[model samples]
Target: MKKLFNNYINTFKGLSIEVWWLSLITFINRAGTMVIPFLTIYLNESLDFTFKEIGWIMPFWGLGSVVGTWLGGKLTDKIGYYKVMFTSLILTGVFFFLLQYVNTIIGFCTGIFLVMLVADTFRPAMFVALSAYSKPENKTRSVTLIRLAINLGFSAGPAIGGIIITSIGYFALFWIDGITCVLAAILLLQVLHPKKAKVLDTVKVENPVSVYKDKAFWVFFIAMFIFGFTFMQYFSTMPLYYKDARFLTEFEIGLLMGFNGFFIFLFEMPLTKWLENNVNSKIRLVTTGLFLIAISFIVLNFTNWIGILAIGILLMTIGEMIAFPFSNSFAIERGKKGNQGEYMAMYAISFSLANIFCHYFGMHMIDKYGFEFTWNAMTAFAFVGVFILLILLQILKREKAQQNL
Candidate 1:
């Protein structure tokens, strides 16, 4: 047992102090992420909107995420990640507070878009910062550490959001969300003592190839889009399924969602460390992850028992543990080969598009057909992602073989 503990501890040894600080900042920001997870529930219950209406409203966030990340990519290349991160942190916090006042369908459409626009700009810049702070050898583990922080915060946010909704009301969720975002920004500025020359890469890569010209990256974009489509149902429609099919309360749903984060926190880094040493093929790793997600969704279709929920979440969590860090590291490596900001922006945009498609499609399927049908549909989606990744693996191997000559 002591030897096992030391092995786990060794996974974290090489990361720099700045990487740790970046993880801390992400934790602070994400811990306050109370609004998005429960947005579907709030719209359905509080506003008395139909599932269709909730679906319509939710896609605006994806639209915003797309627009925000695109602009952030441009800004990061021009200004530096340090400034982009700081500005996004501050404005995103303010937008969360402002989003509370919106009530009508139009208001929500506009408000959610704006809030997500500011919020998601943090993603590519954050990725760039992760690469800048850590050594080349430690990049994947650094990504995992940051992800661990995100899941840790995710674990806390939903549980706390559920309690807030029950104890005070939904309105209070906006306040806490807004406060924490701003607090994260302040802490970022006041607490993190950054050396400007190291973290800020203001210099441009001259004659860089356009990301649109990269065939491998476009293939990756497709895989990530489908992955996002299949995986994100955990946030959008799955909660409604829990409420409708299993007769769970808001608190119960939150606990189940929190379980995803807690599970990832406990095991993702160690798993990544093991994989990096043992697995040479990242695309293969991603394909395996997608297969797990397909099973996760299909398992739900087979069993109506509540225990199936745990089983589904477990499978999905492991899939995510495998997929996300590797995908992130892939993007970082791909970007370094050409224009980092451009490649990373497209990476973020794939998920933005997925966010739009996933929520609307999941809600529509559930509303029109049933949970069982939606689960099967999500399973099919996951399998499609797996197919794409397999093709991607073949393309990467061919490209590597040509490069060797």
Candidate 2:
């Protein structure tokens, strides 16, 4: 037990204090993410929204994320990460408070869009800051530590959110979420300095179009979109499945969803460290992760028993633990010195694009074909993503070899 405890401590040994502080900020911010997980329930049960109307409204949140990440990347380059991070956190909190007053579909949709736009700007800025704070050798572990914080908070959020939704109602979710965002911003203000936060010591601006011109990055972008779309079904469609198909309560659904976070928190950091030490190929690790994701969804076709569902969620969480941070690390390593924010932004946009695709198409599938078909389709998508990413990895290898020659 002492040996095990010491190994865990050794995994985090060499990182800077800034990295630790950033991880704390991530934890606090994500701990209050009670709104979105429960938003579907709120729309369906409270507002009497059909799945179709909810689908329409959800894409606006994705549209806002797209805009926010793009603009945030540009701002991170021009003005710097600190200002963008500070403004995003504080304003996002204010918007969450504003959302509590919106009752109509139009009003709710608009509010969601504005809130996400302000909130999601923090994503790319945070990635840029993480890269800035860590050494190259420690990059993957650094990002993993931040993800550890996020999953820890995520594990807490939905579990607590379930209780809040049951006892006090959805309005309380928003108020708590808003307050936490404000608190995270206040904490961030104390630690992050403008001079220290700049990703590049001497700024060399690159045109945003340069990312598009990199053929290998374009392939990577497509793979990210494919994988992201498949994974996002957890948010857009899975909750409805738990409620309608399995006949579970909202609290039960929250527990199942929270299980994903809990599983990752228990295993991800140590697993990532082990993989980094033992694995030689990032491509193999990512492909295996995607395949695991496909299998997780495919298994759902055979059973909806709670135990089976927990197993499936565990597989999917393992896939997420392996794939996501490595993908981010890959993008960051490939990026030019001054273009870190833009590279990370493009990666972030793949997730936003997935949000749009999944909610629009996923809800439609569930409404028409039912949950079984939806899971099968997602499984097929993951398989296709794996194939494409394999080819892209080969292309990247050849490109690197040629450059070396």
Candidate 3:
């Protein structure tokens, strides 16, 4: 047991202080992420929204995310990561406070859009900051550390959110979420103090348009898009499935969701480190992860038994542990020094696009067909992502060979 604990501790030893601070910031921010997880439920039960109406409204958040990521990437390169990160954090907190007052459908939809527009900017900037702060060799571990923080906080958020929703109301959830965002921003303000002009001058100025021209990146983008679309069902449709189809309570739903974070918190860091030491191929890791995710959904089709649900969630969490951090590392590796923000922004956009597609299509399927269909569709989508990734690996190899020649 002592040796086991030491091995886990050793995984975190050499990372920079900035990486630790960033992880702390992520923990703070994600701990208060109460709104989005429960947004569908809030709309359904509190506001009396139909599934169709909820579906239409949900995609607006994704649309805003799309805009936010694009603008954040540009601003990060121009203004420096510190400023972008600070501003995004503060503004997003303010927007979360504003979201509480939106009562009608249009008002709530617009509020969701605006809140996400500001909130989502933090993602790309965070990635850029992570890349800037860490050495090349520590990059994947750095990303994994941040993800570990996120999962730790995520484990708390939904459990607390379930309590707040049950005990106080939805309004309290907003207030708590907003306060935490502000607190996170304040912490960030204290930590990140880059010399703006010098930093900007030092950064390489890549043609932003060139990112779109890279065939390898485009292939990566497509794979990320599909992976994100399938994965996002956990946030978009799975909660509703638990409540509506399985007749679980909000607290029960929260527990189920929290299990994802709990499992990731326990295993992701160790798994990532082990993979780094043993697995030479990022493509293989990602392909295996995607298959695990597909199988997770397929597990759900077999049984709604609580034990089976836990197994499915565990599988998905393992998939996430293997896939996402490596994917971010792969993107960072693909880009030149100056283009990290641009590349990460594009990667972030894939998730934003997935949010739109997942909610729109996933919800529509649930409304028209059923949860079984939704899970099966997600399984098929992940398989497609795997196929694309395999092709992308080959293309990258060919490009590398040609460069050598």
Candidate 4:
């Protein structure tokens, strides 16, 4: 454990301004994300909104993420990360401040849409910043560090949000989130100062439409979309599953999620760097995570052992830590030089797509078919995804070997 801790420190021994600022900003944004777990409760209890109403309102988050991911990536390539991050932070804060006015379902949805649109934009700019500052060997470490900050924030933010909500009100949740966002924006503006680099002279001027025609990129798209399907299940369905089982209290749930965050903080950096060293092994881990996710649902359906369920959840978190960063790395590896934004944007689209499909189908499966059948169905999808990713990894390896030869 001590050796592992030292490895984590060594990963960031001499980080630059860009890396430090990006990690700090990400921590703030992720801490703000703590409001999410409580938001449903807030809507149902405090605001007197129904589940169906919240359901209708929630699409705004996915929709806004899609727009934010695309625009942030594009603008960063053209203008730069400084502008992109600053603009996203300011707009996100403004929308967060406006959450207080959302009385009707439509108004709430609109407000959320605006907030997500602004907030999600920061992602690509941050990724571009990481890729820019670090050498290829250490890029995974840098990305892992950013993820670590996010996890650390996630670990702390919810407990804090819960306390504030209990003492003050749900209104306090949004208020605190908004204030943190503004502070993050200000810090980002003040700290991040990248020395401008020369643009590629031979960069192609392909029409935006032409990017869609890249056959290889589309293969990546399909694989990642499968991963996204599983990803959204965590946020949308897991809470309901825990509720149905009657294993959760307000504070316990917060702690479980905080555990999730803590695991990411503990393991992501070392695991990511170790996996990057062995791409083939990393691909295998991705499949393992997916398989475990499916099995977790199967176990959840059959047993009432909360202890066992907790173990299953721990497995699922391991799978996530293995799979997600690799997917990001995979996308960057596949992009042609100078098209990082487009690739990153394309990578992000999978999450938006997953949010849509997972919510619709996952909810239906649980409502109509029962938990066992729904999870079994998701498991089948995971099997197919695993097969597809393996094929892609093989092709990537062969292509790389040929280039080296």
lDDT of each: 0.85, 0.84, 0.84, 0.73
- Minimum summed lDDT over a 10-residue window in model 3 is located at 195-204
Report the Cα lDDT for residue 165, model 1: 91
| Local accuracy of candidate 2 as per-residue lDDT tens digits, 1-405 | 999988878888878778888999999999898777678888999889998898778878888999899888878776777788989999999998889888888998889888988888898889888877787777888899999898788777887998998899898998999999999999889887754543332335454446767787878888889889988888768888878887889889878987787777767778888999999777678788888889988898896566778888888899999998788888877665337677788989998898777777888898899999989999998999999889987997897799899
Off by over 4 Å in 2: 43-53, 162-172, 195-209, 239-256, 302-310, 370-372
User: Of the pair 3 and 4, which is ahead by TM-score?
Assistant: 3
TM-score of each: 0.89, 0.88, 0.88, 0.87
Residue-level lDDT tens digits of model 4 in 1-405: 999678777756655556776788889888886688677787888789988898888888889889888888788778876788888887777777789778888888888888887887888777766777656556556767787887778777887887887798877777778888888988876776444332111133364433466665676678778877976676677777766755587567756756777777777777776676666554566666666666655666666667866776787788788777766665655443446677778788877778767888888888998766776777778777778877876776786799899
Residue 238 miss distance in model 4 (angstroms): 2.8
Instruction: Please give, for residues 1-405, the per-residue lDDT of candidate 3 as tens digits.
Output: 999999989888778888888899999999998776799888899889998888678778878999999888878777867888899888988988888888788997899888888888888888888877887777889999998888788777887998998899999998999999999998887776674211211235554445777888888899889889888888868889888878889889878987887777777888888999999888779888889999989888886586887788888888988999899898877655346667778989998888777777887899999999889988998999999999988997898799899
Q: TM-score winner among the candidates?
A: 1
Between which residue pairs do clashes occur in model 4? none
TM-score of 2: 0.88
Error of 2 at 144 (Å): 1.3
Cα deviation at 40, candidate 4, in Å, is 2.4
